[model samples]
Target: MPRHPTFTLRPLHAALCILLAGPAGAQTLPDVVVSANRQEQQSFDAPASIHAVGQDAIEAAGPRVNLSESLNRVPGITVLNRQNYAQDLQLSIRGSGARSPFGIRGARLIVDGIPATMPDGQGQASTISLPSAQRIEVLRGPLAQLYGNSAGGVVQVFTADGPERPELRMSVDAGPDGLSRYGLQAAGQSGAVNYVVDVSDFQTDGWRENSAAERQHLNAKLRWDASEQTRVTVVANVFDQPVSGDPVGLTRGQMEDDPRQAVANATLYHAGKDVAQRQLGLVLDHRLGADASVMARVYAGQRDLDNRLSIPLFVQTAPTASGGVVRLDRQYSGVGLRYSRRLPAGDGQVLFSLGLDHERMGEHRQGYINNLGVQGDLKRDEQDSVHSTGVYAQADWAINEDWSALAGLRANRVAFRVKDAFITGDNPDDSGTASFSATNPVLGITRHLSADTNLYANIGRGFETPTFTELAYRADGSGPNLGLGSASSTHAELGLKTRLTEQQRLDVALFNIASRNEIVVASSSGGRTVYANAGRTRRSGVEVTHSAQWTPEWRSLLALSTLKAQFAEAFTSSGGAVVAAGNRIPGILDRTLFAELAWQPRAWAGFTGALELVHRGSMVVNDLNEDRTDAVTLFNLRLGWQQTVGAWTLRETLRVDNLTDRAYVGSVIVNDGNKRYFEPAPGRQWGLGLTATYRF
Candidate 1:
């Protein structure tokens, strides 16, 4: 196993000291409210680790291309841009989802109160529409368990509501490497209805060989007030990506030789993917009384995908090999209902909530041999389905002036079934079914030390089931690995929230987690991977966040996280490698930092500017720790101008990323048998954006 090294951040320390010593502004920060505990409450009073990113911050970040652009401002989370449009962003929280080769697992995703993650614990971040987002909320630590299975953490996006007056807006953005985006939006409110609609087109030429992509997006929201106590809302969205090139990862040697070159097979086989998706949802809120209410939601969606992989022709000839080409048509839907009531308790009040949710997904899956990018003979066919149901109850009580308590319990059941449709003399029927169930509980307490300080503690249990992708292959090149089991975890956290002055705030949290039967990659080759289990593992970490307003025109924010994650019991991997206890987990960095400074003087009228810094520590690529990537630091800058005349508003922005033009690896593929692990980051890039809005 590789030895963990100490990290130095002298520059960051100096910056912090300077910011802390600066003169304080007179403007006071406003209070924040959150729903992380299934109930509405002040963030400072909630006994959980939760953070919110405002719309202003999001708009100032960059071109609004991906979540990785701004998520770094939050502590205890990691989101990386792989520069491969065919694949989703690589995301993890506290080391839980680092092992995923594609898409997202071990974390939950929600949009407008609708679940974006499927019942099988798989999700894609591409469906989110950042242009229309009002705010984003993130929740981590023990309190996250209340969300049911695979609750390592939660990320939720909320769309903006319509304005009182009718408005139309148009935007254009251009960047290096022939990148461009065009967008249009309309929003308004009538007698009893509110509506918002948005559409966008994005295209980019190759930054590296064989890496180009194009996409179109549409999002809409409508709300109606039936009466004084009844409300209804409808949401619809569409996503289309006609094509996205796949530039496969490179070995260290290949990256050093030429970071801009694609692997030979990528071009030879024309590796890439095509995707389309459509979804619609409805939400209802009714008030039974001033202290009681009921909420219900229903949603349905469909997704179609076609992907081509660069597997050697010889490998596809094996009797049980699935193939090099993949196709999927999936239909999914879900419904949820919740009831809440508030009652007087002691000097304050208690809020009670109970809810039930059910979801299902069915897919037609097919695999075919690839004859130089063309589909050839059929190799496999199957029907797959997953069903999940959960029931939960919670109570938050403000027992007295200085004390509060929260308790919750949840039960979940998930079932998976697959039917074989193509069978041959050499391949026997591989149909199978698997089911998992668990009950989780969480408890928390908070103490108000003074008007400006609060301390809290919490503990909970979490569970996760293997996604169908993980069950598709076995280490020995057999069929689905039904023998794989679920993983469970115990989590605890202690935190502090304090207001240092009228314009500054600080948040700190410490957390620990222990898990059994942790899922891991046994081997990966030719775009396919097999799964196994490690007996036991541990993860502990500390996170710090600070924000300050100095002299009204100067403001700063900083977030830092340090973690220690490792295997706790010795185990022999299916790849014939002996993983010793205490080996550091692969694909997870031990430390990360993000800091920013902004200057927006009142005297400057319409001009604003900011500087940002991001740092990531070294990480191993495999269980044996034979190879790793170097730590890297990046700097970014942005400037903006806004003007209004008559009934029109105009805004423009200039941005630059990776200012130093440093070469580095942004992410890795863990346990890749072919030793193709590193994905190179882009060099210095620049962008320009302009938007115009007209109101009537």
Candidate 2:
């Protein structure tokens, strides 16, 4: 007997942008345009879980340095600021990516319709430029599976278009712990072309011992009307971080004694990382007919990385050891095309979309011994590459006046190849190749309950494959784990969107997911880790969001998420420890809540103020659930003032975080073999910012 999968998903932009615009006593929420279904559609009518963070929310009294600063407000999404910039933030959706060792996996990241995530299903958010961003959209649940491999969710960032009139803006921000940022932006329209350019530099000096970092970013965009029915856009960006110190994690006792202290080995090894990246892309859109259109995009990028780890000196002596210092020069590129058409139906119309995506990444990887802060003799070298291709088709039908249906299918294939360059006496040719493929399908339906209420449900399949890093070693230290299998999942979701009153809106969703051959760490020793397939795992969650405009000057928002993620079958972990069937997944909180109250007065010179509260439940550090972080609650406050005179505009902002000065763990390292798992959150901190703009 085949078991049917069942689940529920939430709404689109449910709690954001409700009061960003509109008059003092507006009765209806503003309409938002989203690309959740690979087309521009009203979010209120979309049958998926999606949210958009606008420019106002992203730039509100914040440094605009990290995505974690603004993503916390979205329900069912978690952005853990490690504070150690060398490792990047840890992001997860509904517990899907909780097991990541570092960086991002189990999700797809897109910037300007170009994939930020590599074909191997790994990504870093450090390259994003927030200063010139217009909006960020997050999509979750079954519909997200249409994006292909590791599509536990999808996050996309879009750059703002140029202004109608020429303008120049400069901003400066300063804070405690030697934190500072300087930014410049220029935007204007000239003839048939519109352009926007931004540059920024940020630095921080030791928020914790041995944790200093500096970075610079440059972003540019240009758009033009190529023909009467065609438009073209070009985007380019660069990111450079010469160095960022890695403090690593601390033990429970070490955190209790002093939360700001770095691990002893981290200082001894001088752990750190250096990164540089540049990318360019082009997009073209053309109208084929009154009810038909076509879009195409091409992008390419290169990244250079040098990372130093805290592995002991003796660990490098082993024949199979890959050394403590790592270097990588990587090149990635992709191309995409989509065509959409509308056909007449009995009562409404059927919208059809067809698309194709192809991407590839190649890397020159090397390893060297870390002799203190310097690199020693080479220990390993290899050339690795991955290629991914996907084809999909979708249809949306307005079955009747009160009902709608959506269906989509996608086929994907990923191939990985490695060639060994360091074939020493003891290390034979460790090169290997592997390939994985999957076909995913999704179906959704929407029922109109009333003029102000909608009910939706969807179901789909998802797939994930092991990355080059995960397959780098075998549990027995033989060679690459080419036998490791991929993971597949079934997802289902149900949701409700309703307006409780003229000024209040509510969104609720429930979802369930089950996976087979789930990936897990089989063992970890020295600087190497091996992975294996677990029997089964399950994740179930509920999300709710409420937004209300009490008056013209008062607004409130609330977002809540609760998830239960666990192993569905018993499994053995590192050191032969049996993980019980019901053990909670490591590094994922069971519950989280965010609430905010904002105020603005027309008579106070454009003054605005807001108070925010955040709460998180305790999370286990390892698969055994033997150790956990403490639950915590935090408060934040922000105030802003703006004044305009003639052609000049000036704005000032003040922000305070962790207002109660509570000490807590911000994040945890899952399944760390050495028992160093805790990353402590900072105490009370404040920042001030000033901006000036001129119109010509």
Estimate every model's Cα lDDT from 0 to 1.
0.87, 0.86
Tell me the tens digit of each residue's lDDT in model 1 across 225-316.
99989999999999999978888888998988988778888877788889999999999999999999999999999999988888888887
Candidate 2 lDDT over residue span 1-696, tens digit each: 111222122322443454433234644556568888988787777788888888988888389998899988888889898888888888898887777767788888888888888998888889989889998888889999999998999999999988888999999999999999999999999988999999999999867887899999999999998788999999999999997998888888888898899887788989888999999999999999999999999999999999888889888657877788989999999999999999988898999999999999999989899988689989889999999999999999988879999999999999999898889788788888999999999999999888788899999999999887788777765457888999999999999988777777778889999999998866543335678888899999999887777777778888888899999999887578899999998889888888899999767868999999888877898889989887777899999999898999999999999998888898988777777788888999999999899999
Of the candidates shown, which would achieve the greatest TM-score relative to the real structure?
1
Show model 1 residue runs off by greater than 4 Å. 1-18
> What shift in Å separates residue 664 of candidate 2 from its native position after superposition?
0.7
TM-score on alpha carbons, each prediction: 0.97, 0.95
Residue 241 lDDT (model 1): 90
**Which stretches of model 2 miss by more than 4 angstroms?**
1-27, 523-528
